[model samples]
Target chain A: MNPLLSSIFSTGFAFAILRVMTPLLFPALGVAVSELAGSVNIALEGIMLISAFFGVIVSAFTGSLFLALIAGLAAGILMGALLAYFHLKMKADIILGAIALNMFAAGMTIFLLFLFTGDKGSTSSLQSLVFPEIDIPLLKSIPVIGEIFSGHNVLTYVSLLAVPFFYVLMFKTPLGLRIRAVGQNPHAAESVGINVDRIKLYALMLSGMFGAFGGLYLSMGYVSWFSRDMTAGRGFIAIAAATLGGNMPVGILLSSLLFGFVNSIAIYIASLNVPSELIQMIPYLVTLIALAVFAIRAQRKRDKVGEVLEHFDPEAVKAVVKDVIETEGDI
Target chain B: MEKFILKYFTLIRTLIAILVGIIISVVLIYIISDMPAYSVRQFLLGPLLSRGRFANVIENASPMIFCGVAIAIAFQAKQFNIGAEGALFLSAAVGTAFAVSTGMPTVLHIILVLLVAGATGAIWGFIPGILKAKWGASELVASLMMNYIAYFGGLYIINSHFRDKDAGFLVSLRLPETAWLPQFMPGTRLHLGIFLAFIFAFLGYYFLYHTTSGYEIRTTGNNQKFARFSGINVVKVVILAQVLSGMIAGIGGMTEIMGIHRRFNWQMSPGYGWDGVIVAIIGRNHPILIIFAAFFLSYLRVGGQILNLMADVPSELVLVIQSVIIILITAEAFLSTWKNKITIKEAERVEVANESVAQ
Candidate 1:
C-alpha cells in the first residue's frame, strides 16, 4: 500500500541499493581478506564505531578532512593491535578478546565524545566535514545505468573498485599465497620459513585498515556526524555477507548488494504505516532466512557426496534448489 | 603449598587482572580529573559510603546474576549463544502482559508470570538451537540476529497491545499490586529478587556439577563427536542446554520488571546479556564464580556511577575497565607460561633426585 514500494520499479531504487551496499561492501571485503587468512575479525562493529567517533572529533579539531580520515583509520588499526596483543601475545581466546574490544570501543568512544563536546548521544555539536559525492563527467551523460552509478560519495566508487583490487591482492600476489598457506597449514608454512605470526599480524592490520574505511565512510561520507552505537551491528552483517559469499571478493560484492536490496526494501516498507520497530526487524529476518538456506544447501551437498565446492556448480545447485522446493511443496 | 598454589592459579591470574584493571582505571581518573585523589576515593569506596548506595550494588547484581548464570549454562554446553538479551526482553514483556491483564491470588499470579517468562524464553532460544542442530547454521549469528528481532518485536508488542493510555510513554500497563515483589527494606528498591538471584546461582552450580544431564551437556560441549560416540544424544543436549539457559535469562528479566518496576517495559535488558558473557569468561564459566564476578562488576558499576555524579568522570569508564579485566583474565598465555615454568622446575627436581639416588 505504500507509494514508496512503487519506487522499486524505478532506477532510483537501483541507485539506493548501490548506495546502501557501499558501506557493507568495504567491511565484507575486509572480512574476506582476514577470514581467508584464518583470522576472522569479530571487532568490525567496534572498529566502525571507534572510527566514526574519531572521524568526527578529529575532523572538528584539525579542520582537515585528510588528517581526520587518517586518524579514524588509525583508531581501527589500534583495535587490531589490541586484539593482536591480547590474542597473540597474551594468548587470550580470540573471540572473547574481540568481544571485549567491542565493548571497549563502545564505551571509550562515548567517553571521548563527552570529553570533546559534552555530548553523550551524538556528535551533533561538532562541525565535521563530509566527503562530496562525485558526479562522474563522462558517465553522467550515459543511459539508465549512469543514473544508478553516478553522483555517489567518493568512497562508494572506491568500494566498488576495491572489489577487483582485493580479488587480485588475494588471488594473484605472493603475500596472498603465503597468507593462504599459513592459514591452511601453519606447520608446513613455518617449515618453509614463512613467519606465521608475522603473516597473521599483516592480515590483522590489513583487515583493520579496510574495516576502518567502512567505519570512516559511515561517519564522514554516509552521514555528516557521528552517533552513539551508529554501526548497529552492520559489522556483524558484514561478516554474514563474507560468509554467504564464501570469502571471495566478487562473492562479497554480490552478497553485499543483495543485502543492500533487502535493506532498501526494509526502508521502503517503513513508509507503509508498519511500526518502525517491526520494519527494523526485516533486514535481520532476511539475513536469518538466507543463512538458513545456505546451511540447508551445504547439508544437501554433504548428502550427495559432492564435497562442498569452492564455486557454484550450475546444474548441481539447480537440482538442489529444485529438490528443496519440491520437498517444501510436498510438506 | 605447591599443590595448593597450582590448584588456584586461574584465580590468582584473575585477581591480578582485576588489580591491573583497577590501577589503569585509577590512572585514567588521575588524567581526567583535577582532584585525582578525591576521584580515586569515590571510585573505590563510593558504593559503600551509605547503606542505600551499597544496596544499589546488590540491586544491580540481581539481574546480572540471572544473565550471568544464563550465559554460563549455555557456554558450558558448547553453544556460543548470545541471545539471552533477546530472551530476557521478550520473556519479560510476555510475563508482564500476563501479569497486568489477568487477576488471581497474589502468590499464584507470581508463579504464573514466572512460568510464562520461562516458557517464552525457551521457545525463543529453541528456534536457533533447532536450526543449528538440524541444518548446521552458525548459532552465534543466528542468535545475534534473533536478538534484534526479539528487541523490535517486543517493542511492537508493547506499543500495540500493552500500551498504558495515560502514561504518555511507550511503556505498558502497570501490574496490579498482587504482582509487585515485596521489599524487605521499606524505603529501598531492594526486593526479594536479589535473594532469588542467589538461589539461581547456587542451583546452577549444583545442576552443573552433580546431575547426569549436566555431564551430558558438559561432554557435548567439550567434544560433540566424542559425546555422540559415547552414546550421548548430542543434538538433544545442545538444544536442551540452550533452552535451560533461555529460561534462566527470562526469569532474570521478569524478576527485574516485577521486582523493580512492576510494569511491562520493553527496553533491551541493560546489556545484561553481554555483561553476562564477560562475567562468565572471568568466572571461567563456573556458576559459583559467576556469582562473585557479577557482584564485582555491579560493585564497580555502582562506584563508577557515584563517581560520575560526584565528579565529571563518565560512568562508561567502568565498561572500559571491565573489558580490560575480562580480556586479561581470559588470556590463556599466563596459564601456559606458568605451566611451562612448573614443568621445568619439576624436571630439575627429578634430575636432582636421580643424582642423589646414584650417590
Candidate 2:
C-alpha cells in the first residue's frame, strides 16, 4: 500500500478527525440554535474570540480552570445579549449589529492582550490551564476503537454529548418549541402569547454558550494560548455547516465531521509536494460547492412542484370542488 | 424652521453619532492610558500636524474611496455581498501578474492591467450573486466563504508562480515602471489613484441616480416582490449589481498595488474592504457621501497610527470607535423621539398655514 494510504487508514487518522471536529461541532451547533430562532448569529467569530481571550486571561491570572470557564462563558453571553439588545431593542439590522460586534471583539481582545501581556499577537507568554483528558475504562479495552476514542480531551466528549443535548433541547422542550415557533413565524408566536423577544434572547444566549465552549477548546485544549484572529474563519465555516446540515443537530454533526475529515486530510497532505495555501483553500472551496449543490437541488424541487401545478386542469379542479361541496351538503 | 430640521435630520443624527463615538473613545483612552491628555491630543491633532501625515490620510482614503463606492452600489441593490475583501486580494494578484510579465506603453499598460483586475473581481462577485439570485442561497455565507478561498488561492499563485526567490520573502517580482501609478505629490505617497477614486465615486453616483438600470437595481432592493410585480427582472439586477461592485473593488485593489505597494506582496487581506463597508454604512450607501466617509475614516486611521507611534497606544483603538459609530448610526431608534417631534412640528405648521390661507 502507498504510504499516504496507509497513514490515512490508521487509527491515528480517525483520532485526528475527532480532534479537529470538536471546534467546528460546537460552533455549528451554536449556529443551528440561533438560526432556528430566526436570529442567525453572525457574530460567532467575535464571540469565540472574546471567550478564548477571557478564558486564557482568567486562567493565567487566577490559576483556576473553573473561573476561566465561567469568565469565558460570561463574556460570550454578554456579547450575545449585546447583539440582541442592538437588534431587538434598538431596531438595528441584525447582520450589521453582528458585524459590529465581530469588529469590536477582534479589536477589544487585541487591545487588552497588548495591555496585559505586552504582546499583540498572542498570549503565549502567559501559562493557561487546559481541561483534562479522560479515559473511559470500557472503551480503553477495545482495539482500534480504543486508540481512536479512549483518551481524549473532556471537551471532545462534551461536544459529542452536545449533539443529543441539542436535539432534546431543540425538539423536546417547550422553550425549544417556542423558539422554533418564533423562528417559523414571529407574529404567530406572539399571538400565542409566547414572548418572542425573550425566547430569541435565550436562543442567542444559548448560542453564545456553545460558541464559548468552542473558543475555550481552541485556546486551552487545542493549543495553550489565545492568538489574534485565531478562530481563523472557523466561525464562518460553522455557518456553512449549519446551512448544509439544514440546521438540524444530527445533520450539523455529520457536516462538521465531513469538514473535520477534510481538514485532517489537508493537514496530512501538507507534508507532500502540494503548496500549503492550496491545501488550505480546499475546505472553503468544498463548502462553497456544497452550498451551491444544496441550493440547486432545492431549486429543482421547487421548479418541479411549480411545473406540476402549472399543468393542473381547471375543469377537473372545479369538478372536485363541486363534489366536495355536494357531499358536505348531503352529510 | 421645521422644513430646515427635516432637511438636515440625517446629517444631525450622523453628527451626533460621530460625536458619541469620539466621546466613547476618549473615555476609553482616559481609563487606559497614564498620559490621557497627551494621548487624546495626539489622536485628535496628529493627522493635521504635518503635510506628510495629511497626505497619508489622502493616500489611505483613495483605495477605501473605491471600495466604499463599490459597497454603496451593491448595498443599494440590497445584496449583502461582502466578498470585496477576497475580490480585492485576488484581483490585485492577477493585476500584478500582468504588470510583471507584459510589456506595453505606460498609459496603455496601466489601463490594461486595471481592466484585467476589474474583470477578475467581477468573476469573484458573480459566483455569490448567481448563487443567491438563481438558487436562493445566502449571499452572505457564500461571499464570506469566498473571501477565504480568494486569500489562499491568491497566496498559492503568488507563492508558486510569482515568488521572487531572491527577495527572501513571499513576494512577486517588481512591477514594471510603465504599470506604476504616477505620484501626485513630491514629498508624499499620494498618487494619481486618488483622482481615479474620485472619478469612480462620481460615476457611481451618476450610475445609481441617473440611469434606468440603476432604477431597476434600487427598486429591486427597496422591495423585491413589488419590483417583480412592476416587470423588473430582479435576478438580472441582483447579478449585475454584484458584478459591477466586484469590478469596482477589483480596480480599487489594482490601484492600491500600482499606486503604493508596486508589488504583489500582501501576506493577508489589507482590510480596506471591511473599511469600505464601514464607509458605506456611514454614508448611508450613497456614492458621493462615501468619499467623505472614506476621508473621515482614513483621518481617524492616520490619527491612530500617530498615537501608536507617540504614545504606545495600539491603533486598534480606532476599530473600537469605528464599530461604535456604525452601530449607533444604523440604530433606527437612536434618536427617534427627536425625529418624531420634528415631523409633528412640520405637520402642525402645515395645518396652520392652510388655515391662514383659507381665512
Tell me how much of the true interface, by contacts, candidate 1 captures.
0.76
- lDDT of residue B198 for candidate 1: 90
- Please, what is the whole-model Cα lDDT of each candidate in the order they appear? 0.84, 0.90
In model 1, which runs have C-alpha deviations exceeding 4 angstroms? A6-20, A114-127, A141-148, A172-199, A243-251, A254-272, A306-331, B346-359
Question: Lowest lDDT 10-mer window, candidate 1 chain A?
Answer: A322-331
lDDT of 1 by residue, B1-359 (tens): 44555677788889888999999899888877778899899999999999899889889888888888899888998888989999998888888888888999999988888999999999988988888887888788788888878888888888778889899776899998898778889678999998888999999988888999888888888999999999998889889888988999999999999998888765554688887898888788888898888889999999989988998788888989988898878778766777678767767877899999999
**Candidate 2, which segments miss by more than 4 Å at Cα?**
A1-10, A115-119, A125-127, A191-193, A307-331, B352-359
Local accuracy of candidate 2 as per-residue lDDT tens digits, B100-141:
999999999999999999999999999999999999988988
lDDT of 1 by residue, A212-310 (tens): 988888999888999988898788889878877767787888889988987887777766666767766776787678778877876775555343243
True interface contacts reproduced, per candidate: 0.76, 0.78
Instruction: Give the Cα error of residue A195 in candidate 2, in Å.
Output: 3.4
Q: What is the interface RMSD of each candidate, in Å?
A: 2.0, 1.6
